[model samples]
Target: MLLCWRDVLLPEGEHVTEKVVRSSTMMRVVIVEDEGITRKWIKKKIEDLGMGFVVEGVFSNGSQALEYMNSHDTDVVFTDIQMPVMDGLELLEQIQAMEKQPYKVILSAYDEFCYARRAMKLGAQEFVLKPEITEESLRSILEEARKFQDQRNTLDQERLKSEGESWEASMRQLIRRAGDPDDIELIRQLEEQGIFLSFPDMILVDIFFDGVIRKKLALELLNLFLEQEQTKGTAFSCSEQEFVIFYAYEDHENSLKQVQKLRKVLKSHMGVEVYLGVSRRKQDCGWGKMYRQASMACENRRFFSIPGCQSYESMRITAEGNPSEFCFFQNIKQIGVFLGQRQYTEAQIAVERLLEAVGEAVYLYPAYVKTMCNEFLVLYLHEIWKYDLTEEEKGGTGAVELLFEQAASHFHLLKEDVLKAVSYMTQLLKRKSGINGCSAPVQEIIKYIEEHYAERISLAQISDSIYLSQSYASTLFKKETGKKFSSYLQEVRLEKSCEMLLDSRISIQEIAVRTGFFDAAHFSRVFKEWYGLSPAEYRKRIILQKGNRIIQ
Candidate 1:
């Protein structure tokens, strides 16, 4: 009655083990035996054991079984030794080398005790003789394997959970670092990372949320505005109470227009009242300037201002101004203080009053007003150019007159620049208007020319791409952009040729071809006209300048 394994086996004369049993909870198992009849018999016996065990697969040879085991998730493997190719011993060795080896039971007909001992040494879970293949023996081995699988599964889940927690913690740390402090050093670091930060005339908007979760929502809304498709060169920061946004653009009026669009989006989406103040751009502008502007814009929002935004320009300058008598310096300082303190409403009121006074002055003293406005605009633009300078010339000269000259020429070539500026200002004042007024089609024409300047692209090709008649496109383009299409294209090509001349490594002929010129001789003629020097002379001058730097 002791139920010994050997006593349960059928006589040696029988080819198959005749044990009929079944289990409800099937434990996954793999049988790797070369003999088909023996493998089938063993599988049937395993299924007969009502202890809930299921055979997942049966491989005819040890090699095939090893390949299946390498890719599969099996609880137990029953393999026979002494096979023709890749014996169970070899398969056991391979399994032991795996990172997570399966529980293994060796099934053999040979009464080789030595083989059993070897299997045990190779980490085999159990060794069973073919004649002693009884349900009791099978049950013992499966129970042990299932226990091992459960432990491993628990460990795997714990490991995955830990990794998830660690990743989340790292993200939280990064967010904290970004929020720790707002200062010049931080802004400079961001700039070094290729985030543009320069605003000569900035309107700072401090958006505060009333509800507990509203602040977070407002911050998200502000960030979305900065990343809007139509808005470019925008930066922002979020703190507990406020979110500050800075807008930098080539044209101040255009920037304000974009901000107005953002204001409308926020009002429609969030249903929260947001205050804004505009600050004049400082000579030394960075995070400090941004903070100052936002503070001022917020302060200016208090004086019966609309729910959205206001600009410093709207506050100080009037269409009817005797420009000479306007106190530009005093108004600038007052607006600066309003922004610095986040007094947006006060700033708006002050700016509006100042603008009215300036408007009166403009009519009384038109010439003086023109001079003052030009001087202020130029000074503001020059400060911005300093931020755009290359790293090597951080502290180098920033000449306003030179930038003004460039702007004048640029405006002459692109007559729509002033119109675009005007349209942008109008859009800003009218919040509901979207940014569809700019001559985007003309801009597309300019962009295409710049990109294909190295190729021999023609006006006909560009006109077709922009969907305009060639003659009409040429005439309209010239009228809107000030320069003839052909002239602009030529200027772009010549500018590229001049840059190539500085390289010295490129031959004149190669430069000519690269810059879309027909031949080197023709290229030389255009180069001389543009720069008053041949390609070789330009190269010589660049080399001399480099040599002087090295000597110094």
Candidate 2:
């Protein structure tokens, strides 16, 4: 009954011919031969196959085999073509129709090759003629079937992995806009594509950046940080300068340790200042709200001059929720009006009132306090521009970053900067108006100077226009306007130059020519003499200042 498979050897160095099957994988088998002797022999052969094959049943007809398989599972079904009741083909169909189809092998005589081919087309794994059936042939067939199943399992695993990745991506999106019905619907659709997510109570950690970092690099670092803490967390980019991490609420102590690890890694490895705002654990549709709380907490950390974690719950008690009680917006608007009117004293008084109101409203949220300060500074800058102040008098708006930092330690520094702007504008206004009450001829001279200051002019030219001698015209112009002819014209041209510097992005060289300077270097020299800053410096200072001055 056995054929020698001399070339085959098992992993244990046993001869493949010594056993009908050599694999460790136990394959349940059934026999459906109509001949009693052949069915008995097949069953005995499977039994002799040793470890891998188990002869589950021996049937005289395909009907009995199918009936046996109805309740019991078989890994491989071997059926003879000729049967009394249901033929092997019908039995193969019924077996293949089962929820889990077994590996089918058809047993046929040499003359039943056509039947074997038909059975193979019906999802049978192999066909073995009765005369050629051998230990080697049956074992090879079973080995081939095992390989196929292994490959299928691998493919299934790969598919599962791909689905897991898709699920994670969808979860990130869902968490970002959590509580939104549309996003929740999107999550359901994503589940159809692969895996499903049920959100547990979670905490949001918002990381704010003080400097620039590439998004890809930041994400990688964040992942590494999570790995170091052995924490399972999800991170997504929030903005150009911020990122957010969401971790399931496991334990408060462990979560705090994760935050500390992240902060340390960001500082030691990335050389960056990071502030983390942690929100309390929230479940269901509160992810978006939790994000806002964490963001507010993180932003407020800047007020302490320290880089560390801030918890939203810690600050909730102090936030008054009524920002209007302080009248910050009203006093800020009044101060702007007074500055526009060149009422330095009145603007100072309004500023004092605003500060006093702020002091009294110490119960306000830290976010509101920072926002009020920024609005006040922006409004003051806008008003300074209205008074025709030079860029040097504006103290360069880039300094606002420093001022904000200082306000954390010394709030008075901001007040001093604002008052300095007020005084600078007032002094500039008084000097510009020294010729306000000049005589009619002097007024006429001033008017001509204003209209034609861009062009070449001299005291002689002015006196000729007025029908007076040059020497007498000079004395009269000085006595009435309190400025010599050349000094007055220089003042008018410099003032025009300052206006162009603040309001326009035109080239400095073109500005010099338009402002009646012979060349850029000469114009810069005169500008530096008057404003204590070169033309380039003045433009940079004002541009920086204006950029930071957002309307409240």
Q: Which numbered prediction scores highest in lDDT against the true structure?
A: 2
- Inter-residue clash pairs, candidate 2: 397-545
Root-mean-square deviation of Cα positions for candidate 1 versus the true structure, in angstroms: 32.7
Error of 1 at 224 (Å): 24
Q: 1-552 in candidate 1: lDDT tens per residue? A: 111122121211111235533332346788888766677787888888755677766776677677656544567899999885699999999888775667899988888889989999998978888899877777788788888877876886687577764432332223223322345445554455345444344444555432233555665776677666334333344434345555545565576666677767766776766556544455554444445444444533432333566554454322235643344656645654654454544654565565545543311222223333344333333333433233322221222222221212111121222222222222222211111222666666766765677787988988889898889888877877678888878876886676567667789999999988999999999889888998889889978976663333
lDDT to native, each model: 0.57, 0.65
Q: Over the stretch 1-552, how does candidate 2's per-residue lDDT look in tens digits?
A: 111223232222233346433243566777777665566677777677664677766776777677667645577788888777798898988887775577888888756667867887888888888888887776687777667666765775687577774544554445544544235655565456432345454667889777777778888888776666554556777556678876655676677766777788776766678888888654444555577677766755744435788777665312256632343555666776776676766776776677656544422344345455656566555544444333444444434423332222223334445554444444454543443567778877877776677788888888888898999888998887767889989987998788678655678898889878898998999999999999889888877765554210
Cα RMSD (angstroms) for every candidate in the order listed: 32.7, 33.3
TM-scores of the candidates in the order shown: 0.26, 0.43
**90, model 2: CA deviation in Å?**
72
